[model samples]
Target: MNAPFGARGTALVLPQPYLLFLGDTTEPGFAKTAFGLRDWAGDKCVGEFALPGATVTTHLARMTPAQAYAEGARGLVIGVANPGGMIPPAWRKSLVEALEAGLDIVSGMHVRLGDIPELAEAAALLGRRLIDIRVPPAEIPVANGRKRSGKRLLTVGTDCALGKKYTALGLARAFRQRGVDADFRATGQTGIMIAGGGMPMDAVVSDFEAGAAELLSPDAAPDHWDVIEGQGSLMHPAFAAVSLGLLHGSQPDVFVVCHEPGRTEMLGTAGYKLTSVEEVVELTILLGRRTNKAIRCGGFSYNTSALGAEAAIALMARESDRLGLPVADPMRGGAAFDALVASCLA
Candidate 1:
């Protein structure tokens, strides 16, 4: 989830029913995170705990897994201060205490791969795997709306801060200009909207309005249509995989992925780095199809330079097309994106 945007604030009681705990309760972004909780839960959640300064012992003692879960914690999004945060001498005992309480644990960015074993015993006892949020950050609730009549949906992503949202918004603007009824819905933190800039939540307020419209009319232009802008592959969990799952549920008609040339070239093929463009692409398509999901075009997130963006988008298109799939046409922007969505419906 996003930290505070404009100003530094403490926790705000979120209206939403679900809660995701990031770092210690005192982190800079705690309040903003609480705001996200309220947004997602729609003002149903009691609120979240930041747990700063509170030792694992005191923290777990108060909440007690049984109490927390019984109070309606469907899932627990846990982010350690760090990997070592789990095994530290003081925390070890408290960790054990919380685990014994039987709370299902889901890991956020703070819980890396190497830290898996740190909580293994607790995880097994809890009867749930410590979900890897980094793979896609958050567990996207299946998109709940009228299914897209189309078949294609473009998905865009970049290594980290490569401007994925702007590219997605640009595509949305392109399609809207073409009269293709597009709404840029962001699926992750940047899109969840809290504060300053980057994927504003105001962008997706249309969903709320659409919900109101559906309740009122049941059938006007499906409220809004076109596009769903999303965050990049960093920050949260299984970014691509989770996004694809969301697409499956929403049934977007096309796909466009954003790629950064310099990053995609070097990191795209590497296995160890989540930055691998190729790995992300292959894994995304494979999992999407395997799960019977949607994701036709895998577009690239390019820099402002037309030449670089065009080249990367072209290469991705060629490679994806060679493999018989949809890829963004960097040079054609609006036409290419519109065509992909059109093709999905056809």
Candidate 2:
């Protein structure tokens, strides 16, 4: 993969099936997101490796990186749910091995290649550029100069990991369940993932309406209830204010919050510390209130325990009610989530 950064023009030779690094078990259990991606790909080709209980040092040392690379693999997606224990030099060497094998690297969480000193040369090895997602909040232009209707609105966010995809998907799914002619799309990561994988224009546009367009334009899809996901935390340097700005700009009828309780204190790659769920929620509340958009429901990671789910749903509900919004009860499944959305519009 030759990297000249920008979402403009990207090409992949499909070197092998996508290789996903699941990171440590503390990253929200990985059940729902993994299952979703697995189903989306229609194959169980994702490679799951266990990170050391406290650090990635041991894992990086015993590497035959070439062994992980598949000649047919399309690219590699490294999920650094935790970076606390990561050894920069060791991790950098492993990444270099993967690049030498001709693998296009896609990183998530706090795996910023450019941030580490040892990895500078390695970062340069694969076109000398890392994929940095930095979308800021802006207003979307309406098509044909049509003004937006004030009443019905929709919004969504991620509570844990990249659960924003699920939140966005659930909203779109809920809209369809209600027979509402709505479409789905995501701006940041998911959009790039789809477009890079060769998704069609209509689908991409629809996906954006579902979740991505809200960041840039307030009226990205005024006629349709758009459900978009937030990248990570405000504290995250690479994370942009634009993601949340999109939801505010759209003036969503309701905002759906998705999160994983397990990620509160996850140990990440390269010994970098990550914020907890409680901390993240605090940041989220600050950002959520930044725009006039109101949160309608809160969705938890699939791995949330029954009791944990109940408590989270209740806490979110109380918060929402305080804000005059509604919270979704996960026990009712996706349909229940959808019903809550429809009620919000009512």
Candidate 3:
């Protein structure tokens, strides 16, 4: 799980009023790092910078490295993730400029910033920090499987890059709005960037994945809720191990299925059809029962960002009726999402 934006974690402290670098990215999905920051932690971001050919935008004011630094931005976050998670040589010039302008470099890419000669030398010469969000802690204790005191609601994905993090963030905010103490427990680098601190579930050793998750959401007051961001899909052929380990460690009292409507196939995979919501709910319950016998699905969260307002609402209604569970696009807060919050509390 993660902390509130700007929250201090001993390992890394990302300075606020940041500049988001979109680099040469043209794909929206690849620019998730920027979108996530803009959507969830807008207050911490000051502006955006991108290479000339880039079409993607976070809609923040466009700025140069010096301009952003002059505007009080303390860091320049690499806000894109390509297939290999590697820093393109084309992006290094802007990174070095940001360092020369007195902004630290922050990244969620798989490649460590220190490994890149240009970024490493620039940061070292300029006394700037290179923060990598994907790195897990040096030691993660093995999960004991003992039940914890706090209540938890995990968002399980039907596929990767759906709505798990957004759902948890919205749910956690809703819970606190209703006077319940809650925290958004993040599990990915993007979630970690938005929430400040989290264990990268996919980065942890397989043997310690469950342990990392356990450390993520610790025991808390009985009434408190840890709205956890989920990792890969349990039905995802290549990434199910991390998902299963997270499920076992989270031992959620409740979960919400997060899906993107109209997607017929798994992302980043060929010929693998998407799993049904019913299948996800059933399987999650079946596997999750190993940890919490009372584990149950609270609702469904749809990524309706690509759908029209009325159409999105109608789709959720039909699905909710079919599944006999509350369904919503938490981003479209209304009676529907309120009902979802109610169901989780119930």
Candidate 4:
């Protein structure tokens, strides 16, 4: 169970094998949630359910609510984000249909799923749940900046939605594969859903953001490793607070800076250029030292998905040699990934 606020646990347990719902999303960027689920938690996804005119697809078999329900899907996760996180009127019928088909609705929208009259009423009538993942706990404590026990590795990024969550997940999995006890601590809606529990770091109050991070990774066994999911970039003008708070609160002994290879500028921010890997490392250590004096860089997790095989390998090698730190694209695990994993444990 996840303790989203501070120390207490969650009742946000959602049903498994989700049917991703992309409601008329035409643009690929708008369907990030759907794509994330497919990429990270593909096994838990039964199929996709999209409304009419949705060009964006997960490439999974398309299924309606009835077909998805029959295929054993228990939840219909709202997989597209509009400008305001508001549910359009056009999406209600599809949501209600899912409820009638016995699949609960899971959403990460700013607006509550249960607050929407049509979806709420349908769920109430069908005895199905309307899970809203973005809601913070009732009470959250202010950060005390107290350091906790055990080892923690947090993933920091150059910008949002690159590969922080992916790297954390991959690292945690690799750690466990080597018989090391590690857990992936999720911090966002997509990650929270995938991990089955997590602190909604962005949803937390500014004062309690650090406190929530503290509770999110409490004192564990000395050998245990909590691989915490990273949030926004420190250089990002809008969302640096959450990143700072998580850094100060988690008090990680090691941190990995995640970055995309081709991003010239920060995602969604035109004029602001993406911070260099070297600069990110320097700033992370400077700011992160406030909470954990022994804090150090683990390595780099590069999103080299867009690069060719040879180019990706070459880039990773060049960066690793220059920085004197292991650099690996976790998706292409090799000697580089092995070295990266070794640095984390070292």
Please identify which of the two predictions, 1 or 3, would achieve the higher TM-score against the true structure.
Answer: 3
Highest lDDT among the candidates is held by which one? 4
Candidate 4 lDDT by residue in tens digits, 294-324 = 9999999999999999999999999999999
lDDT of 1 by residue, 1-346 (tens): 2222223121111112233443343443333434333443333342343344733221222354456556765444443344343424444444444456544444334434236565676667555454433333112222355533432244546544455555555555555565665544444443333211222212223324223212211121543444455444421243444344343443443455556555423234434343555555665566445323555443444453445655655665665565454445433554445554444344
- The parts of candidate 3 lying over 4 Å away from their true place are 1-13, 24-29, 51-55
Full-model lDDT, candidate 1: 0.42
lDDT string for model 2 (216-287, tens) is 223433455544434444444333344443444444445454545445432233433455434544555555
Tens-digit lDDT string for candidate 3 (1-346): 2344333232234666689999988899898789989988898899999999999998999999899988899988889999998999999898899999999888888899999999898888878999888787776888889999999999998899888989999999899899999988888888777776677899889998888788887778999899889988999998999999999999899999999999889988877999999999999999999999999888999999999999999999998999999999999989889999999989
Best-to-worst order by lDDT is 4, 3, 2, 1
C-alpha RMSD values across all candidates: 13.8, 9.9, 2.7, 2.8
Q: State the TM-score for model 3.
A: 0.89
Candidate 4 CA-lDDT value: 0.89
Which parts of model 2 are misplaced by more than 4 Å?
A: 1-17, 22-45, 49-72, 83-87, 109-111, 115-129, 134-166, 176-225, 230-244, 253-327, 330-335, 344-346
Q: In model 1, which range of ten residues has the least summed lDDT?
A: 8-17
Relative to the true structure, how large is the alpha-carbon lDDT of every model? 0.42, 0.42, 0.88, 0.89
Q: For residue 296, give model 1's deviation from the true position in Å.
A: 2.1
TM-score, one value per model: 0.38, 0.49, 0.89, 0.89
Q: After superposition, how far is residue 199 of candidate 1 from its true place, in Å?
A: 9.8
